[model samples]
Structures are given as C-alpha cells and as structure tokens.
Target: MGFHSFESPYDWSRIDTYRRRAEQCPGGLVDLSVGSPVDPVPRSVKEALAAAADDGQARGYPKTAGDDSLRQAATDWFRRRRGVDLDALGADLVPTVGSKEAVALMASLLHLGPGDRVVQPKVSYPTYAIGTQLAGAQVTTVDDPANTDSWVDLPGVRAVWINSPGNPSGQVIDRAGLSKIVRAARSIGATVLSDECYAMLDWSGTTQVGQNVSIPASPCILEPGVCGGDASGVLCLYSMSKQSNMAGYRAALVAGDARLVKAMTAYRKQVGLIVPGPVQRAMRAALEDGEAVMAQREIYSRRLRALVQALTAYGYDAVMPQGGLYIWAQARSGDCWADMADLARMGILASPGEFYGDSHRLRFSSTISDDQLELALERLHTGA
Candidate 1:
C-alpha cells in the first residue's frame, strides 16, 4: 500500500512552465525536451500492420508470449545485429507493450519487495527507481555503473538495471565493462536487466572485438563475452520505437533467462499486459528489415551532428554521443536550469539535468525533423 502512495516520477510542472515561456518567444518553439521520433514509420512495417489489421482472425485475443513468428524474428535479429546467439533460448523471449512498461514492471514481476535492494545507475531513467518502489523495494545508486567494484558487495541487492547508451547522458558500456558487471552481479546472486532501446543508433565506430575485428554497433549485455555466452540470470529489454519509429505502436520485448521470462509472461498474461496482434506483426516486419533501421540511424546521425555544432557555436560544451538519441551538454554557467532558460529565450527547448538525477547538464534530443533541426541551428547561430 505504501508503494501505491508514491507520486509519479515525472514532474510535468517543469514542462508546463517551460512550455508557457516558450510560447511567448518571437519565433515558434523547436521542442527537443523528449526523444520521441518525428519521422514516419517504415513502409514495410506499416504495410505489415495494415495486413494484420485486415485479417479478421487477428481480432481475437493475442498471446501474451507473442506469436512464433515474432519470437523467431527477435531471435534472428539478436544473432544478426547484436552478435548474440539466442537460437536455443527462443522460449525465454516475450513481447511487451514497450520497453518502458517492462522497465516499470520488472521489479514487481520478479517479486522483489520489502527490504530487497535494487541497484541502478546514479544518473538514469527515473522509471527504474519508481519500479523498485512499486515493488516495495529499496534502491541503491552506483555512480560508475560500469565499474564492477562499485556494486560487487552491496548488501541485500536483488536486481541490477544496466542502461547502455544511457538515456539522459548517452554513455555506453563496452563488452568488457558489461562482462565485469555481469560477473559481479552473478557473484552477488543478483539478476541483471539491461535496457538496450538505443543500441541500433550507435554513433561511435569503436566497437572492436579482440584486436582486429570491429563491429560498428553498441555493446549488448547478451554479447558472448559479456555473459560468457550464457543468458542465465540476465535479461535484455529492447524496443522498436527509436530504430523503427514505432513508438506509438508500443512494440518491445524482453529476452533471456527462461525461468524469469516464464514468470513474467505468466503474470503478464493474468494482468492482460499483451502487445496487440497488429503491433506484433509490425514488430516482426521491422526486425526483419535491416535496411530501414540503417536509414533511420543515418537520419539521427545527421541531426545529431547539426545540433552538436550549433550548441558548440553557442558557447555550450556539447559532446557527441556514442549512441542513443540525446546530446548531453553543459553550459559555462554550471546551472542546468539557467542553460535551459537561455535556450528557451532562443525559442529552443531542452531538458534540464535535474530531472535525470544530475544538476549541471542538459539533454538535447536529436529526434526532431530536418527542418526543425535547421531552425534550431539557425536560432542558435543568429542569436534570434
């Protein structure tokens, strides 16, 4: 009952205040506070959704575990893109409405409550803490999540949430770093749940395996070296929102650890947390079309470069993200709210770091349209 008393993690008051100020600016606002995609969904995915919708048989209640085709597509995607072999672990995968729901429901689904401690990144998506709270579990923040020593011996730690290409910061953890965390969590008898929603949008070309083999992709927790080629005690949460522009469809899934997936799937079935049939079909189509994913990635990359250049020219220290849809920036003033207000004065809106558990940085999203990005850049350069 105490968890039920907790307030929502999002503070809409800040957004409302900024929205009102932005409305009064001379030019129309170029909103970049959130990372929601502005581009249209791929034709292949949309066609699949339409076909599924036209199928009268798809109107029936869908399976909570997802269709066999979806599961197969997800597994094939992991093998082809993430360099992870999940062929034998097909039964461990289950589609969720979206990665956010899986994130908010993981602790409860795992039955962690009353004195159980969940380890999370110090600066992370707030939903992780909210989910732990919802399960009556305590949260422990590790500032350097990639450092295994930071969490190896934490008392009462039951679950660890790893977010590579992190939300607010866009920081990525390499395979070696992920392996360290996995080993540490295993030693402590804690489960690891990795959020990999932005894996496909990697901007860094430093994904080297061993000495000579380089793969230009974000490191996955389920990578062979990261988890010793075994997915036991680990789960990965992925979404088709960023890569496929399917955020509205709410298509995502959790894969790894057969027992845990079975537990969550059983609970989700009872509660009706199923992804719709049409969305699942769309997801399968999206997973199969690698070319579409690459095309979307290139769009974000261009937007990211333009935004970073504009922010840099405006006297802000904007760092290029290795992956993910945000550029973590800091102003010389050392005040996030002050930087946010300045951007608002320029008719450009960005998220303050306070919302993401940090106070000196701001998050600028690169998911805006090309025209809007150009407008934002023009405003920054012209001081309009």
Candidate 2:
C-alpha cells in the first residue's frame, strides 16, 4: 500500500479509448508513446546469444557478479565509449537484469528505509520514486539539480539519483553541474547514483555550459573530472537496451565504488538476482560491436529529424532534444490532455508529460520504424 503513495498507474483506459478511436482513422495507429525498440537485433549479438544457448551453459546458475569476460567488456566499454575508466577485473561492477532492476533495487540494497530521504529529479522516470518508496524511504523531489545547494542540506538525504540525457526532458547535465552535485552529495555522506543509460545517444556531440564545453557523454559520475578520478560514494548505471536494441536480453550493469558494488553483488547473489549466462555472453558481444551501435544511432537521428520537421510544421513547439530517444514537445495552449486528444484524433499516441512529473508536454519516441515514422509525419502534416 505504501508503494501506492509514490504515484498512481497511468490511465491506460484513456489510452485504450484513444487507441480504439485512432484505429477508425484510415492510417491506423502510430504509437510513439513508448521507447521500446522496433528494430532488429544486431547479427553479432544474436549469433553470440544463440551460440551461448547452444552450448547449454545456462543450465547451471550464473554468477551474480557476472563472468570475467562480461566484466572486462563492460570496463572496456566505459573507457572506450564513455571516457570512464573502471577496473577491468576488479569487484567494482556487476551485471543486472536490466537498468530498471538496478534502479529499483539500489535503494533497498543500500539499506535505505523509513526516516531516510532519497532526492530525485522532480520531472524524471517514475522508477526513481518507486524504488525509494519500495525501500520505505521518503522521496524529496529536486526541480533543478544543477543547483546542488538546494538538496545538499536536506536532512536525512541518503542517496541522489541523476539521469543524463534525462528521460522525458532529454536534457543532459554538464560536467560542471554534475561535479557540483557529486561534491555536494559527498560532503553530506550521501551516495550519488548516476543513471547514464542514455549517455551514448547524445544528439549534441558536445554539451555546452556557457562558453565551456565537453563531450556530452563524458560527464558521467565516474568521469575523472566529475569525481576527481575518485569513485568513492558514487555509482554509475548503464544499459545496453537503448544502445544495442537488447532490451529483451535484460543486459545492464552498475559500476563504481568497489566496496558498494561488492556489497550489492553479495546481496544479489544471496537473493538470486543473476543475469542469465547466455545474456551475459550476448552483452559482451554487444559491447564490443561499436559499428552496430553507431549505425543504430544514425537511424534514430533520421527519425528525430523527421519528427521535428513534421511537428514544427504542425505549429507544435517541438523541443529538439540534445540526447535520448524521445522528443519532448508542448502544445501552443500548454495543455497536455488537449494535445493528447489532438494526437489521438490524428491516429497518433504519445506519452503525456503528466506521466513524467510534468503536465503541459508530451513525449514522442524515435524508436518507431521508418514506415511508421513516415505515417506519423504524414498525419502531422495533413492534420489528419
């Protein structure tokens, strides 16, 4: 029941009603409300998974800490792609079922509970609050995390969650802003968990803060500049779901703070939260295939361009996201439900901002197929 205190489920009946209404249109429905990938899996990843499965090694229980190859691949990925150097063979990382599992369990594994506080962005992925509440911890929403001073002094604050190329908003925090939050959290003895799942999908190659600029993907919590090359009291979570179209494989990992990772590994082992061995092997293959990842990014980029052009022509204020898979946009009237109705009438469906702690915008995902995207664009153009 306490979990219900976090937030109510989205009005799916409303979505269903809209779905039925939209189906009556000649173009059918183009659901851009969710970011689930519609593309095919990379051949390398699929082959690797098939090979591992044929080997029949999955009959045995897999290690909760993941195998050495997987860990090393993850380390190499951070260094090569994210500019964060993690230990190649140390107990500083562990594979997770998915980033969602890690996000939801981090608070509980850290032993946060009643009377403690978990600070998360006011407009964020809903799971942050759910995880805190599941741990019996209170949630403190921070509207402007760039202003670290606002949350640093909050009493009982035990953990802070930061998302880059943030969901819903698609805003990437700069290196200096991340450093300030990390420093503030460290000063108060709280752990900072940076969710960098969308780090590699940065639309803007560089993040600009005034005149100073840095690679958008390199401002991770584990980045040397962000944490002074010290991973103490900090952790970074990443997922291959978005980057590699491996969401069904549940491939994700948490790295940073050897002690913290070790503790999480031990707890997860006892609780049977292990990644499938076959999935682990597939993840390794996915991490090593940089070409496939880049190609996928370009596909999404094209879709983004199409959506922005069409939405702009329709008189909607389409916010060009710096990164991530979704386009955050606002109706001229600033009424999300009105926008939702308009979209439904055009046989389109987008996630309303109300679902992500905002009430005046909608999120359009770029993960749809090229044909589906074209249909959505045509509808937008014709005001169908």
Candidate 2: C-alpha lDDT: 0.84
Please tell me which predicted candidate would have the highest TM-score against the true structure. 1
- Which stretch of 10 consecutive residues in model 2 shows the poorest summed lDDT? 207-216
lDDT of 2 at 96: 97
On residues 241-339, what C-alpha lDDT tens digit does candidate 1 reach at each position?
999999999999999888899989998999899999988899999999878888898888888988889888888888789889998887547988887
Please list the Cα RMSD from the true structure of every candidate, rounded to 1 decimal place: 2.4, 3.3
lDDT of 2 by residue, 1-384 (tens): 123245544455756776777777786899899889989999999999988885545878778998888888887777776676675323288999999999988898998989999999998998888899888899999897878888888899999999988998888888889899989998999999999888878986664321122233535778777787788899999999998998898999999999999999998898889999999999999989878887888898899988999999898888679889988887556887788888888999888888788878888899999899999999999888
**lDDT (C-alpha) at residue 78 in model 1:** 84
Clashing pairs in model 2, backbone N/Cα/C closer than 3 A = none
Candidate 1 C-alpha error for residue 51, in Å: 0.2
Off by over 4 Å in 2: 1-6, 9-14, 88-91, 207-218
